[model samples]
Target: MELMTFESPVNAVLSGQEAPERSLKRRVPMTARTKQLSDKEMDALERQIPDLAQIATKTAYARALLVSDSVLRVDSGDLVRISLDGSKTVVAKAEPRRKVKVGEVITVRRIEDQTAGGRA
Candidate 1:
């Protein structure tokens, strides 16, 4: 016995169609209302999302510091531990990713590693 494969010229039956959020088997009245957005609905959404995200992140960080007295963040390629009393300490050095810089070496390339305890 031999296996056969058929070539599909059509990529998908519902290529550009949107799927329903609710169950297909759910019953609904014929008079059920549906909301449709304007053409610029996505554009409006994209504009406001970043601002909301920043606010949410700031709020969460503020709450975390208030409850735990300290928070950590990566600054200038170094892990910094910040305290509620306006104090900062370098917890660990996060070195920059090392990759071969392309092109001819015309000038002396300085090693840009920020992490401590590495060969010069």
Candidate 2:
């Protein structure tokens, strides 16, 4: 005996154009919804945040005062008075060998350095 192989016919039956023995199944439908919150509810949610009182408050040091445009041309041991921003005055103990002369542009620069003793 010999085996036989044949190709299926390409017509309405293979393409599903004709009615089949059973009907096809249908897919289920889906739906979604969103809700809005009231102002009171939103405020209650905001209240959950912690209050950082200490973090908000900070301490700062007093700034150095600046000298006027006119320089003080005085010899050693000459006491000079300079006006500061807050209607205050700074008495600069003059040194004999200062490079600045009177009527010269002067700027006061204050530098604070740390000592090995750990005192500022």
TM-score leader: 1
Each prediction's TM-score versus the true structure: 0.49, 0.15
lDDT of 1 by residue, 42-111 (tens): 6898899999888767766766566567777888999787787969888779767656677846454545
lDDT of 2 at 49: 50
Distance from true position, residue 116, model 1, in Å? 22
Pick out the ten consecutive residues of candidate 1 with the lowest summed lDDT.
Answer: 8-17
Which residue pairs clash within candidate 2? 73-102
TM-score of 1: 0.49
